[model samples]
Target chain A: MEYVVQTTNLSKRFGKESAVIGLDMKIRKGEIYGFLGPNGAGKTTTIRMLLGLMKASSGTIQIFEKDLNKEKINILKRVGSLVENPSYYPHLTAYENLEALRKILGVPKTRIHEVLEIVRLTEVANKKVKGFSLGMKQRLGIAASLLNSPELLILDEPTNGLDPSGIIEIRNLIKQLPAETGMTILISSHLLTEIDQMATTVGIVTKGKMIYQDSIESLRMYAQQKVLLKVSDSEQAWRSLLGNGIKADWEDGIILLSEHSDGKVAKAIHTLVHEGYSIYRVEEEKRSLEDIFLQMTTREKVI
Target chain B: MIGKLLRADFLKIKRKGLWFLSFLGPFGVIALQMVNYGVRKDYLLNQSDDDWGYFLEYVHSFTPLALVLGIAILTSFMASIENETNAWKQLISLPVSKMSVYLSKFMVLGSLLFVSSLLLGVFSLGYGILLNLGDQIPYLELLKYSFYPYLAALPILALQLWIASVSQNQGIPITTGVLGVIFAYSAFILPDWMIWKWPSLMNEWDEPLINVMLGIGVGTLLYIVGMLDFTRRDVK
Candidate 1:
């Protein structure tokens, strides 16, 4: 139960707007922790705080068992980061960009070649980044982050601006990092689907608050999967479905039993059809990360 | 770590292509003298010792002005290079203290400009030597003449570095630096005895006695303040 990063009551304020409010987070060692929330939900702000890029308006941050504010240099020596868009000198070659970062981090030159290989940028390493596509630039950024062989890596929207294939490549790369190097990763994105495949644990935030945090498997079981019901008699069917100990919500005349399985839904549907209801539709709907994310945040926004 | 930072700073400074201005400054001084010497070639050769001395003094006077402008432009460009590259974010994230980060660039730009001014002084002195007037002109005396004014101009160099470090927009630092030089020039117009004040000392151009003490005090004050302001201020 060793946590690589822990933030207790961390909050940040920009004049009047509270970008992050009382955010308490825990990211265990060797785990890929996904931070999922909508735009402006404080995901980037939290990451900035953790990296010591921005100071917290209040609260404590601990990185690898060291107090972040007090031991920032020592803590940062073991952590690497890419927050927001990857910034580099457009005129510099990919190798030059990494070289500059290597110098600042005081990493050995050999590590530069190793990271370029890791990010699969060895072929284009000598090419100026100005001509590189967004995906190539992103890979170069990831390569720079890995130059120090850090114990923890924090990335904000790491796959952003990449094509589908590029996304898959980065996803696979992120998936392999922990297994191969024993690095803990904190990936923040507004898109849950992006993190669903890689992250071991997920923290779902809405309106700057952590609404849910759990293992990915538990989150899938308790929050994501839905028992979708397409029933006959679209009007009275809803009433009877609700009446017969079936708790369901309406969407385009399809009843949604959230976080439920097929057998539970089947029993409810059979009861409705047995009661002389003209059942036109009945099928179990598979919920996606997008669906879960939309449901959680939309509900929070409404409240 | 500081050495790494210095290398990165040098790479960035060299990439901006600003060293051309340093060459341009001394070259401009020689060019102007060449044109003037050509226009008055016959009259300048027939002049008396006092008149030749006046021409030599004019060359010496104009050289410092060109040198100051060079220092101002070079300083502004180097300090603002960080804003252009977004290098401040990356550089500041390093384990070093923020003061060293700001001062290192300041020192680099200051040293480059100081060297350029020294070169321009020698170049201007050589231009004077070429006039070939009938008087015994002391070559070593002329070199010492150029060095003296450079010492006095050291405070102006510190002032430019301060402006450059705190300003993000290149225009602001350059504008402030130009105006500062103008102010220093006006201060030097007063009698020499009345010129030991900070602004006046910036243009006091020949008293080694006054130059060394005021140069140390003013340069140290500006460097300390500039570093403090930079390290303490937030980077946008």
Candidate 2:
């Protein structure tokens, strides 16, 4: 299937308030699609709908090229997911916890060892999950979702509770998923940097509306790149650049011109020196994924 | 699917005190008589011509209350296990239907209650032998006293299980369970149609089999209603 998940005008309302409205999501096969949204931006609600855990008020969901409502069991069999925080039987051993799910999944018994090994919990497999740390629990949750060897893995905030290094590890693991196995992943997160490194395609949502959905390259194009000019004559450089039809602003005794092309930069420099401006240093300021994400989600339209 | 779910549910509650509670219900019912016989055997023995009948009547008195309370606890415990682990979403997202999930829970509760009812039979007979109430033990009456209350308590079991399964706050089911226990305690005043009264076999008709039939029929109906409600709604 070209798209692992497709939805049109999906909406979910709780009484008078709408949790998610008019959401159109398209997630392609073999791509790590980042479902980006701020906290309470209806990320979890959308994921729940795709998994059939919650029924949509009005919408259609197709997964694995099959209608979700019609082929729920068959479609779900190839989809593995971990929603929000990982839920586990605290009293049961880690191995036993997966064993419980494995029985329900009707997978092979050895699948328990495989998942435990994949998440690197082999040594502690027999230990009760009550003692596991947050990162370990998240990993175990990932392990549980992979027990069926699903083709599409949907994880909601998988790294929500992890530390910086644990976050990096999970990000790398997600990045390696497509090469290791031809599986598509839909990972939802509020952290733009987390998604930037892990996702091939990004969907930015705010207040139940998707502000932007495209490839990472297209999302990066929205970022506002600038050239920082540290010149002795900051005022002269600003005026000269403005006269050249380039918008220039002064910040901390420097002139910043927005995304002037290489040719324009040379011309702007030539004009600066012609205006008797002493250029001490020039630095290119690349807009971060965080900047682009904030601009797209917070503004009325993606700027 | 139901069988697999039942096995999984059983494994989840392996060391969680539910099994001990199941044993306690039957053992407690028999232990109360142990004290009665130890203290005043003569008074209890002189009441009826048939010693077995008198002992059975006394045993039956405690069975209804214990069975009703046990149903409440078992159903609540089963639901709480899933709630505490937050396993409902994971279970429903599997390649199984929600109806199977409901049936699995009911079957697990039904199986545990069955075991407890069987234990009641064993404990009641062992104690009756120990009392030397009589060599002529009315095996049929003893059997009825042990299992009849279980069968007749089905409607209450189904009702409590339904309440427990859908309720997010355990207190709601517990409250309903407490009211059921109180009503079962006063079954003498309750109407025949009341599920609580069916367990006590206290109806105007005075036929135990009629109550059993009603329990099974009404119990099945409630189970279907609860299952339909559960399958139609989103799992929280």
Candidate 3:
């Protein structure tokens, strides 16, 4: 697979504190690679290093197959980014704000209007950004990022502080970019649900370490529901089910079954009851994606 | 790329009253003379045989202080325009090199000061003509007095910009500027080598051109040093 962005052991240290350590991120072309991490997980630091805004203490960053150190300007020509807060002149109108960047990008002036339209800021194009709500300012940031028609777009918490409708608007816009224009996007957010909704591939970082990096579907697999049984002599019941070729695990006082299909569950219960074990209760343990995400981030371990 | 960045920077500073400040700096210097001549026209006219020369001296007296304070405010304002929105990260992230960004800022501030110098020359000429100082206007001396301080003040401009750009707090640059103004005010006693003293165009050797030469040379040196530091540091 062709990768649009690849970093090898990228690390950054401030004094004795290491912000990002040994991060190998591979983002394929035309994929929405969600950079997931909680607050203070070095997401902004990593993105800054990639954009050449901040220097890495050690390691290499290659964007569009070009060494970031040597070809930063050339690489950044095709890369657009909005880091942390939405940066703007605030005193300038929305149209003027994008126009400022448009001048640097050397794109046609009409491109400004096009990006404004895409972010749905065309109507308020002449309004000063100081009066804009957080959502509007964020949309303007997105508009500025799209000014150059970049092939790779990096946005750190783009939907932050936006209302629900605004969040959906940005989410849909990000989701469509890859399909419509073949642009590769790397969006970082602390919310797992946000990444789960948009990212095709996910790289989860916690405390500056990449613990989980895979497809969103594979991440969802970790959230698969299981069957938990409360039974008298649960240890013996679990062993009895296992001996009968019904695979299950016993933890604390509960019998946990990974394969929780209706037939498999019924068979396990029948075996436990037939073995003279009285079942107190049988319950389906549903693991939400949020729970799995918290476990992965808090445990700080690769799954 | 530098041209484009300059254009973008100019666009960003719109409605920020930077143009007004540029116009005001020189106009304020001349206005001080207006009051000085207005209150005691007869008394001042008898002070020198060359009336226009005498008037130019009065104008030159305030030029250094105004130039230093103006550099401080202008450079600070220029930096705050970007710092206000934390746009430094966004700007550095653009395709343009960081060196070019620093150069563009220096050029913008330089252009503003250049315009202020030009206006100072015009305002002094207009007032000298209105006062009927003399048929022999001593245009060269008027030009020298109006523009010499600006040229000699370049080092301060460069230093102020350096401080303002690197400092996260505007107060640091403003405080430095206040100290510079005080030094400019006491230029008679200050040693000739000081950057703030250079703006007064005063030296023990009694040659104004030397200060201008030193200003250009030291200004270029300070600019390079500031640009190097600016490009080396991380944006955040």
Tell me the lDDT of candidate 1.
0.74
Candidate 2, residues A127-218, lDDT tens digits: the string is: 99999999999999999999999999999999997999988888887788788999899999998888888899999888888878899988
Residue pairs in collision within model 1: A230-A281, A232-A279, A232-A280
Best by the TM-score measure: 3
CAPRI-style quality class for the chain A–B interface of candidate 3 = high
Candidate with maximal lDDT: 3
lDDT of 1 by residue, A72-181 (tens): 78888888777778777776788888877777788788898898898888998888888988998888878877877989998989998889999999999999999999
Distance from true position, residue A189, model 3, in Å? Answer: 0.8
Candidate that scores best on DockQ: 3
Write the candidate numbers in order of decreasing DockQ: 3, 2, 1
Regions of candidate 2 where Cα sits further than 4 Å from its true position: A227-264, A268-286
Candidate 1 local lDDT, B1-236, one digit each (tens): 66777777766664566777767776786687689788987776566555546665656656656656766887877766666556566556556667777767766776676666667666765666676554566665565545555555566676777777667777887887677556545555555432222322233464454765666666677678877877665454
TM-score of 1: 0.81
Q: Could you give candidate 3's per-residue lDDT for residues A1-303 as a string of tens digits?
A: 778999999999999999999999999999999999999999999999999999999999999988999999999999999998999997899999998998998999999989999999989999999999999899999889988999999999999988999999999999999999999999999999999999999999999898888999998887889899999988878888888998888899999999988999999988887889889889998889899888889888765
Error of 3 at B99 (Å): 0.6
Per-residue lDDT for B116-150 in model 3, tens only?
98898999999999999989988899789878898
RMSD, each candidate, Å? 5.3, 4.2, 2.4
Q: For candidate 2, what is the DockQ? A: 0.70
Worst 10 residues of 1 chain A by lDDT: A222-231
